[model samples]
Target chain A: MTALQLDTKPNWFMANWQQLAGFGLPVLAIAIYIGDDIVEGGARLFLQRLFDGLDNGAIYAVVAVALVLIFKATTLINFAQGELAMFGSFLAYVGAVTLGLDDVKVGPIPLGLLLSIVVAMVISAAIGAGIERVLIRPFDPSDHLPVVLITLGLFLILNSLAAFVWNVNPREFPSLFPARNESGAQNFVEIAGARLFYDVIGTYIVLAAIGLALYFILQRTKIGLAFRAVSSNTESARLVGVRVGRVLGFGWALASAFGTLGGALVAPKLFLKPDMMALLLIFSFAAATVGGLDSLIGAIVGGLSIGLIQSVLVGYLGDNDSAFIILSLAVAFVVILGVLWTKPAGLFGTSAVERV
Target chain B: MKAGSDLAASPEALWSEVEAAADAGWPQWVRTLNRTVLVAAGLLLLILPFLVESIALRRNASLLVLSLGVLGLVVATGKAGLISLGHGAFVGLGAFAMGAFVDLVGLPYPLALTASFVTCCLFGWLLGLIALRVKGIYLALITMGLAVVFPSVAKRFPSITGGTSGRPIENTLDAPAWTGLTDSQTIAVRYYFCLVVCIAVFALTRNLLRGRIGRAMQAVRDGETAAAAFGVSIVRLKAGAFGYSAGLAGTAGALQVVLFPFVSHEQFNVFLSFRLYAAAVLGGIGAIIGAIYGVIAIVIVPTLNDIAGGLIRNDGRGLLDNDVIVFGVGLILLTFVSPDGFAGLVQRVGRRFSNRP
Candidate 1:
């Protein structure tokens, strides 16, 4: 009896064998290639790549969530999301660098960078809500053409406007976390011979905080209930006495604020530039598509997976060059195509139902 | 009754007889005057290249090339309701492929042009297959991705695309030796070459869009499910429209190579795609002649910019001074004011005038 019990497979595994195989096959393939790196350069190099991938993945996740939020409520992909994020980052630049707030202190806390980022996010949120109200609300939602044109036009306007304001030059953005200690030592913690920077930790913490804030706002608040109601069914929500327009504005505001956070996190690494978010937008789009356009959890998973694939797969296959970046983009494009072909609704999204 | 039957047998005669009956509405003099103006305009176009400066001639040729590009977008987005934001990629592919065929494979100019069109058509078909799986805005997203990724991909292939620096074709599209044309005369010859191709493509497009396929496409655009119920294959109609549209853009790119003899990856960025879409919207995407007007409207931006620059006594490179900004403003304004674009406005005015009489 004891031998039989020990030999028997788990029930969950038995029930989900097909799903396990489907997921495991790709994971095995990825592991095989990564295993090659582990053998050649030891676990240190593997850890380094993993750490870097996760760091970038955090930023991708934020942007993907922003995209998903808008898609959930409106069924419209904001083509200008990345541009708005880039503009928000510039506002941070204006707050911190231009206004000389980078070194300022408030009470016992070093709150300058935090204040600037928060201010930028708030302003971006307001702008986003205003856009939904003025530019987007006037158009018929069923007809997608005008809205698409408007968003795309906004994309162009915001991009060139930033370029005109900042000139096409790249500027160094102050990091939220200190890069060096008082003793002139690098600020990082060594874990298994891989140094994890404070910025990466800070990014993750802020991401968690934002996630919690969003969760509470969505699950515990009246407005959040209205937002969820509208996102699920606009007509039903309207029938139930919800102010659908204001709820949608709130949704846009949240999406924009999240995008600003993503921009602020990535700015230190990517540098603040007019078009910094362009390629990142493509990656985020792939992430959103792969995870399911309307699913928050899917966005997070998709974003991380894309970041890992780009960093690990492309990193192993190609060297750090322009060619490497192009290869990563190609991989993302292929991923988008593959996902759309196989599962249009994505892993987490509900499949669309068309009534004939 | 016999005279009425005879008049009905000849439709033009019947139309004229009806026009005589309704004499206050549309006069015979007005019809003749319209025909005269059209003929004079055609004659002016034929002679204007020789009369204008070489720069102006080249500009006109490029404008024709741009019209082809806009027409390509009009075909897909206007007719089929497939919004493609990455047609610039198709144009780029055509330009690069044209250069490759002519320079590397040593193909003749006409053959190279044909090859470029086929190549771009194939690519468009392939992408359409993937993109058209799930409907509505996914195609736009994918095509925009294509536009964004094209430059990087083109840059990766150094031999064919000349890497980052770009490729300069050997300029083999000169006037034929049999023409015995002088250098200045050759400019007019090039202009005429572009003009002829433009007219040919437009006529062909007009013919194609009036056929069964065009009706099927319109049916699909109007209601996909109803069209499918009516036995129209949505996939084939859509993908074919995409391929044909791409072919037009490729031909335009081939023409651009002919006009300028250069192909660069950077020239085919997202901005070009945006400008093309903006022009399509501003000029009226639904009408074929709208494409020509769209290109002409975009071409006038620089001249306006120069005038604005002179008035301000500053370099024409300040905020809101760029052509792209104007295009953005135009796209938004057009969407709000005239969703059907300038062609719709013209049609409305025409209708109003015709009704007044």
Candidate 2:
């Protein structure tokens, strides 16, 4: 490791110089290109792109939260976060669709979907705990290489295990949120002459609720304090009588639950499959990277920003065979590189001082 | 125990015995033994396609070629501790270079391969320069992003790379007309071509590692500040490793065109990098000879999956169902149980047989 340098937090505006341009340059370029297209394509297409971007952004943020959870705890990127979530979604799928849990009802409301989600989340939590205990705890967690390798191994295992269990085919998942309102019409609320989807609205509400719940758990709760202590200094926290092992397990569990929930929500729209979240995982990495790796709030904002840029840029690129497919990801990667080059610590990351 | 005691008694006795046994000189005899083994292996490989009688089995060319790419990875990640998760980009760069030089520039096969090597070396050097600015996990992330970017980068240049479809080399070098080889034999010629390249690169890497640059790389990997204090230009040495590794990868990629006949945008996905990583880890990374073991594991993995799948099920599923999962399990288990990997395992075996400490 390079010699660690200490730094007082600089003003956001001061730190923003490189990153602002890193993000803004691409935004400006995309905007100019989109502005050119809007003159010909008009408002409806633009609105659709915005809505799509928001929807994608919301999902990316949700997953990025999961990423931030682990990063906070271990400072290591879990390559299998998506796979683990995909596994959780697969579990939910099994409980709801394969086993017909959705057939059950609690009075007028069907509790089956809710039941499946609860069951899957619990199982996913356990899976996460097991993974940390079995695969991670033994290794030197400070070294990212081993942990990354382990997570990659987990990625492969979970991905192929899902394939083995579910078969390598896409399965339809019921949406947690309804697309239509009570009136049987596609739910839309008009804002600035642009219609918003109820599904999209419901997604936002669910994500916001999750966000609030996370905020409460991280801020207000006792376990959250324990988690923070453990994350900051595992040995010192242990010395101070914190149950570091259990706290680490809890963090992993929470992260996995978030991942599973993110997957369940996304699977409905993208269709449930082992590889469905693979590419999204890459985008989520970008989001996590774009945001400071350690900051939860930064992750959310980064996710939303990346999601918007991706959708808008892709939309602007148009469907020229696989051009959008390749270019969108290429552009995202470039953003990551640009950020790394300009601001190694990231936008919201604690900039460690470099003492020569 | 008695034999061991005899060895403990005198180094002179053993040395004298070895000296007496040598027909030429001690060094010449060892060289002779090495040459003999090489010649025998080469002959066996040359005749393999004829004996196998299956073009599908001959697809081990891909394995050999991929192993060469993994060797490049070892140079960066293992020897230099650079942690490049994006070696596929180097491989892809090389593959595309081969296509451009051979098809576009109309170069001969050898010259085209050299051009591909030189191209990947340049890119690797640039990435290494970036490595100087960033260290540790950050570098890994950057490389990972590069791995993801590579396919699209290749696809963007439709004229050069044939978009997603990829370009195939025309007028491939074939077996001599004198040999009167069959179709499979012609394919086997490609396999031999890969094997020769693999051997050359392996020897080259071995020699580099045995020399001054290799020590400097290891020093840089161990401690950058200390290396700089010792007057080693961290940038030059590190970038040189990157260049060399990428050159190896490029060489592999060039060979891949000969073996596979085409290169696609999809061919050099991030998964390729991961697989190379897995191979390196499994084969005991940083050691050049372990590359063969790594590639062997890679090639044999599918077969193991097939055997398992065949015994377990004969339904509508593919023969190698969830093979990747098995590899995943192998990776996890191998890391936990035998972190040193197959090279360490081999050393243990050799030690056990020889009864050496």
Candidate 3:
């Protein structure tokens, strides 16, 4: 079995100078290109853009982490991850909005919405696990075509199912965090004249909590050991008496939970829709690829880098033209190409050795 | 398993088996039956336009064009063992290029078609170059990115693409005076034109796949190291397959312009790419017949959805006949039942029938 040396560390700048330069050069060029505006407005505009980018980066990181989890465990990319997350958001919507669970309370605490969201996440996780067992486990892992096809199929089915069930109309999803005070002043902390919304802060805190929970689960739990063992080598893990199938399913469940959280966090901003996650999927893929598909920490870094690049570069380039509204997507595509070209294994991923 | 062993032991023997199975292995009666079936199908296709409504003809033209796109997937993913989730982008590129050349360059329809074909081939070749260092899931990621990014890029050029609303190209491939068809009646002419082009492309593809190049592609697909050891240039083979596949997709795009005379960025969204992949799989990857079946399934399923959707339309809300759901279910079922696809299913049936004698 090939060991990934997940704990072994390389100097960040030394290991990823090429990637840094690639992302940095673009931001520099874009900054120079829009120098006049930056000079006139000072660093306020730039700081605002950076904050916005980081806010978006947090969402991508959440989704990218989900992607990395599955990749680490099964060596397969779940193309349907975004849709699964989107579906989870819909479930949350049905619970909190349609069913009016948000109005329910427990002794001076309105935790009903939170409870509903957790329930939605649990349902989505179960679905994810079932998908692994029923659809994925039967296939030979070495043959990638079936897995790819299956995931792509699931992507389409889940997306369409969401559309059918919820219809295509955009729905307003209430933010998890307070948007405004009773006096109607926006609830945000201003840093350098840039308003960092409470929702964004809430998202980060939730992500940190998730990271901590995952850390405990993986480090201290028995299933975590099994999952790590299976991810490293299914054959070896099986030989060592690890329930590889259950561990793989657990990985899927964890991934789906994270994905649901991402979808719910971003829905308030993007507006809940069937196709809301479509573009986000591309961004998260770029994030995952940049971070190394199998590295959790890498996904976070990649997501932030991509988000910053997309926001700043696209913001500057599309300054003069409304036609370039979706230029961020193009930036994501370019980032994927650039990262894969210079470093195929990504910034932190272990390079795989293919056998003849 | 036996075929794998045969391929490993002797490439020549496997090559002959592939070549002669349809011709020499089948009995004379079976061959005659196949011939009769082919002749009947061809004749039916020829007369189909006359019998069907213009809308049906239009749908048939769409089916034929989609088949070409599916065939491209069959060539690249099926035959050459390269996974491309972005052929939809190539198809869109061809459509937009055809629109541009014909409208802006003032070129003839044939010239426009040729130009679109060349443009897509070059574009695919360039993408293939960028992807030279990557393969497998990474390649799929890149291609899918291309698909996702293509529409936004296309929309940037408002003049050429007409921005978000899309532009309509002038209909230049109208029926000749000899055909004595009215303007409205020209639908048949368009259908026939697409039909003819489709047949030619299919024939060329069949020839290409059955020859030496196809064998080399299969070899690369089966084992890159072995193929390289046997002196195949992996780089050239992969790039050529991509270019060729893109060319086929481009031709399909040109035909689409012929049928609809409209090009839009919205039409080339990522779902289009996914649907193409789904159709390619459901029809059976790598099989020409499978592509046809796939196109049939894709085209018919939507119409069926509409019909079923209308009947089951509760308060005009729950559209149970959604094509996406059908395709999703179809792809999953096909994968579980037989990854070889409908084409494989047909082959199994044929084997059952032929083995009896």
Model 2: docking quality category: acceptable
Q: Is candidate 1 or candidate 3 better by DockQ?
A: 3
Q: TM-score of every model?
A: 0.89, 0.87, 0.92
| Candidate 1 segments whose C-alpha is farther than 4 A from its true place | A1-35, A106-110, A180-184, B1-45, B177-185, B310-316
Off by over 4 Å in 3: A1-40, A105-110, A180-183, A320-325, B1-38, B177-180, B310-314
Better of 1 and 3 by TM-score: 3
In model 2, pairs of residues that clash are none
DockQ of 2: 0.42
| Candidate with more favorable, higher TM-score: 2 or 3 | 3
Write the residue-wise lDDT of candidate 3 on A229-283 in tens digits. 8888899999999988899999999999899989998998889999999889999
DockQ of 1: 0.49
Separate clash counts for every candidate: 0, 0, 0
Give the local distance difference test score of model 2.
0.77
Model 3: what is its DockQ? 0.63
